[model samples]
Target: MKCSRCDRDAVIFIRYNGEHLCAEHFMEFLESRVKHELRKQVDLKPGDRIVVGTSGGKDSTTTVYLLKKIFSMRRDIEIIAVTIDEGIEGYRDRAIGVLSGYLKKIGVEHRIYRIKERFGKTIDEIAMMDKTLIPCTYCGVFRRSLLNSAARELDADYVATGLNLDDTAQSIIMNFARGDLDRLARLGPHSVVKEDLIPRIQPLRMIPEKEVLLYAILRGIEFYHGTCPYADLALRNQFRKAIDEWEARSPGTRHSIVSVYDELKPLLIERYRNFKLNRCEICGDPTPGRICKACELRLRLDKIQNL
Candidate 1:
């Protein structure tokens, strides 16, 4: 099929929109939406620093790449790529190498933090220590903690993530299904800035996962394609599978999920607007509870080691 916008052959047919786009139009289609999303998420000023939680995957690589491209002329805006090393041995180790090289090649400053460094054990070790909790249970808490700490340490104005439409939709449905209304309200791209917790920005929040992968390939962005060794055990897997099935059965299902959530999120946030955040007594991160979830998990790990 010919390109929807030009004579070139269509590289991919977008089922959600029913458009056949070539390499040029596909990249443009992706970038333009990201630019719109980014603009809606933040109002950048001179010297405003943005830290991206890059995982060396297609989504993250595209996020960093596009952010750099969009703001290339804005010399005053500083963009840094931060990678979390969850210490999954060959998996995370190899990703950081690819991430580092990519960041270097793109002229973006890069940094890496490890879960083992501050938490006293790698994710791999923690998984072995506790067989009851899923690897993602530990990983999710540790990664969020480390990423926030990394942002605070760097004094960033905003923390960027690579969450795409699929991830966004799954999270919304999962939280709604579990009756986690507050968490549902708190999903990013975040607009509010909380102390010690850098608000997250997701440029790819509206983009689909497959589109991101194709864009990365077409743009020649180097990214690690390895799956996590413990991925099969994630609680999110069930949600992801369900959402994927829905999307396959109904084109634009993901978009409909996010769009409806977006419409409802304002009311959700307003309902919880007055709920206060308390500092984690141990780590001082912001949380609605007395102790942050990360510290709570860490305390559990400590008790396990003592036992």
Candidate 2:
């Protein structure tokens, strides 16, 4: 079938929205969404060093590709890629090779921080040591803490990630359902504005996961195709599948979900404004409670190992 946007033969059908996107139009559509989100969330200033948390996966690789394109139009901002190696044997090692090659080919400055070397424990090691902790959970906790530390080490003014629309929407629903207004308030395209927080920026906040994959494929960007071996066992996977099903049945359901968050953003912000954030007693990072989540998990692991 011909795409309605380009009147060309469509490569794939976005069933949720019944929109046909030709190869070129598909890229354009995804790029436009990225650009809109970036321009909206990031107040880029001259000489801003933006570090992207690139994984060797489709989402992150596509993020690097688009960020490069977007920043090229404005020469004032400097961009670099910072990859966190979670020390997941073949998974991270192989992906880093592709990521490094892509960054080298694109002439983007990049660096990888090996978590095993830094933390003395790989995510898999930690997960295996503690049956209660899931692999992705451990990986996520370590990655966030390490990403912030790496961003600071790289002298980055802002840290950008490849979190897409579905991830953000699912997080929103989870936060709201749990009455986590503070987290919900901080759920915009821009990560955190607090002085102690390493500003997290999501450029592809409005793009879908499928669109990201399609863009990577269409652009011939080299990205790891397989899921993280530990991802299937994750509780987040259930939320992901549920959202995928909803989006499948109701085209644009994910977009609508995000839109509701956007519409209610002011209220969320106001409500969470008085949530009383204090510096984490352990890590000196921003936290709604006494200790930051990352440090708390790390301490728990430490106690477990010591015991």
Candidate 3:
């Protein structure tokens, strides 16, 4: 197909906006949206440090690369990459290698945190337990806790993630389905849950997953293309497929869902703003209750091991 904007052959056809773009225009569109999100959500200053949660996937690779490109001349702003090793044998090991190589190529500082070292067990070990929990239940709670703690330790102004439009839409649907209004309130481009927790920024929340992958390929950005073995067992996989089908049927369905959530998020936040927060007595992390989800899971795992 012919490019909608220029004479070059079109590489992608965005159904929602009805724009058929070539590689150059597509890259421009993706980057411009991300830049807009960053400016709108994150108030970055001259010397602000951003800790990027990179998993060597297409989304994360694109996030770090784009942030660097946008702030290339701003020497005062520092970007560091942090990868969590959940100890998922073949998957995480290969991803770490890709992450290391990419960061080194771009000359960005990076760090890796292993679950076993910090939590006394790897994801594989936790999965083997005779518990009634899904792998993602444990993995999600622990990984998020580790990232938040790492961000605080690094003294970063913001912890940036690679969550795209699909991810955000799925999360909104999931939270609403489960009647998790608190979680739903926290589902915007930036988080403001607690003072101790470094706020998170999602610059790619406006972009789709397919566009992120295409952007990485067109830019020659290298990433681990493998899927996690345990991903099929998560509820998110189901949501992802359903959302993809909806997007296929109605080109802008995903964007509409996220847009609605974005519009309601501020009101939800204000309504829940005065909700009390406390520190987890065990880990000292902020939690709605006396104990955090990570601590609760850790205690459960420890009990199972003892049994």
Candidate 4:
């Protein structure tokens, strides 16, 4: 099909927006939308540092590359990449290598932190401990804690992540389904939970996952294509598959769902903003309860290992 904007053959047809775009226009659309979303979240100033959470996947690879491109001439704004090595042997090791090489090539200062070092156990070792516990339960809790701690240690102004539309939509659905109003309220382009926590900005949150992958390829960004070995064991995989099927049938179902959630987010935040937050007694991270989820999980794991 011909590109609606030009004479070139179309590379993608955005059914929601009803536009057929060639490679050039597609790139332009993606970058412009990301920039708009980014600006809506936070305004970067001189001497501001953004710590990007890169996993060497398509979404993160695209996020880092675009951030550098957008602020290429801004000498005051420093972009650093941090890769959390979960030490999953065949999975995380390969991705870390790709992430390291990419960061070096782009001249971005990068850091790698291991879960084993921080939590005293790698994901592989934790997975061996208990058959009843899902791996993601450990991963999600540990990763968030590590990222927040890393951001604080780097003294960054903001933490940036590559959470795309599909991920957001699934999260919204999952939260609502599970009656998790507090977490649902926290969903947005930018995070504003606590003072000690660095605010996280999601520039690519409005972009679709497929488009992110396309953008990475078109921009010649290097990334690891392998999926996490334990990914299929999570409940998220079921939601992901269902959401993909819905999008395939309804064209813009994912976008529509997320857009509605975005509209409702303001009201949700206003309602939940006054909810009390306390520091985890163990790790001193902000938590709704006395202890944070990460510490709770760690205690459980430690107990299981002792037995």
Candidate 5:
């Protein structure tokens, strides 16, 4: 059937809060989200460098594509693509190939930093060593450190991530559930970059996951379609599945929950400042403990092999 919205032939069905959106309408939805977020959080000046961490997955790949297109239209910004190679056997390598091709096609400069070359351990090796901890948690910790360090090395003004609404919302729920006001207060469309902190910004903070997937498909963007093999065993996976089921029952349940959190953000901020921030003695990132979680995890892994 020809889509009423974009005249493209409709394939997959997206019932967005009782409104039927074909793939093309879905793409518009995602684009609108990106535009809204950009207008909200970003103010680009000429020659300002925006570094985007891409994994060639649906979210990050779509992020790069949109940012490149959007920034290319304006004369005020430079976009740089950086992909962290986590050394996941079949996944990261293939994703790197796809991302490189896309970047080359559009004449965007891209950098791929491999974990094996930078760190001594592959994600798989680390996972094998730390079987008790979820693999994603370890990967996330290492990836964040790598991304921040790389952004600093690149001398970029802002580090952009493909964290859409679903990811941010899930994190909000998790933090609230754990009473982690410090982290929750820091969550928003724009986070101010501190001298000691490499600021990470999410331009698609309001876009839904379903919309992002549709955007990737409609734009013919190449992405890692397979789920992270280690994701099934993670607690976040359980939370994601639970939210997915809820979304099926109520089309925008996740968004609604996040909206409520946003409404209560001021109170969250008050609670956050009530607690004093401390520096990690090891890495010096803001942490309540003497050593940050990432450093602690790395030291733990190191000791395990030594034992």
Candidate 6:
């Protein structure tokens, strides 16, 4: 196909908007949106540090790459990449090898925190010990908790993540489906900060997953291509498949879902504004109830072990 904007052969067909873009234009299209997203998500300041929760995957590597690309000239703003090692040996170990090399090649400072180091168990061990809940239940809670703690220890002003549009849409529908309005209201690219809990910023929240992959490839970005062995066990898999089907049927469905959610987010936030977060008595993390979800899962794991 001919490039929609130039004479070069098109490298991608942006189905959502019906544009056939060549490599040059495609990269420009993707990076420009990411740059815009960064600007819209947070207001950067001198000496402000951003800690990125990088997982060495396409999305995360792209996130760290683009963040450095955009802020490379700003000596005052610091960007550090942090990876969570969930102790999924075959999965996380290989990815970390790629992640560390990539981050170093890009000259971005990288740090790693392990779930087992903090919680006394890895995701794989939790999966083997507990049969009722999925590994994702433990992995998600532990990963989020570790990321927040890592960000705090690094003294970061904001924590950026690699949540692209597909992930964002899936989360929205999943939360809405489960009647988790409180969680939906508190979804990422967070502008408001709660004490001890770092606000999240998503630079690729508006970009599609395929585009992120293609951009990573085109830019010669090195990221781990493996999926977690336990990925299929996630409750989110159902929503992800359904949303993919919806998006395939209707080119713009993903955008529509996110756009609608973005429109209603302010109202959702306002409705829940009065609700206050209490520190978890066990771990001192922020939560609505007396205990946070991570600590709750840890206690569950401990009980299972005792039995």
lDDT by residue (tens digit), candidate 3, 1-307: 9899999999999989999999999999988898898888877788899999999999998899999999999999999999989999999999989889989999899999887888889999998994589879989999999998889889899899999988988999989988999888766556574658778899899899889999999999989999998888898877888989998998999999988888898898889888877889998889988999999999999899999
Model 5: per-residue lDDT, tens digit, 13-123? 655544456776767766777888787777777788888999888888888889888777776777788998888888888778878887888777898877666567888
| lDDT by residue for model 1 (143-195), tens | 99899889989999999999999999999999999999889988987787656
Scored against the true structure, residue 205 in model 4 reaches a CA lDDT of 87
Per-residue lDDT of 179-267 in model 4, one digit per residue for the tens?
99988887655556465868889988889998998888888999999999998898887788898999888988988888889889888
Show how many residue pairs clash in every candidate, following the order shown.
0, 1, 0, 0, 0, 0
Instruction: Order candidates by TM-score, high to low.
Output: 6, 1, 3, 4, 2, 5
Clashing pairs in 3: none
TM-score against truth, every candidate = 0.98, 0.93, 0.98, 0.97, 0.89, 0.99
Whole-model Cα lDDT of every candidate shown, in order: 0.91, 0.82, 0.89, 0.89, 0.77, 0.93
Clashing pairs in 2: 16-251
In model 1, pairs of residues that clash are none
Tell me, by lDDT, which candidate is best. Answer: 6
Candidate 2 lDDT, 1-307, residue by residue in tens:
9987877899878765678889988788778878888877878889899889999888888888888988887788888888999988878888888889888998889888877776678887887888876877778777887888888887888888988888888898778777877778786565447665668888888888878887888899888876677877876767788888887787888888988889898877776666667888987876778997888887887898999
Off by over 4 Å in 5: 1-14, 22-25, 274-277
Please list the residue runs of candidate 6 whose C-alpha ends up more than 4 Å from where it truly belongs after superposition. none
In terms of TM-score, the best-performing candidate is 6
Cα lDDT of candidate 4 equals: 0.89
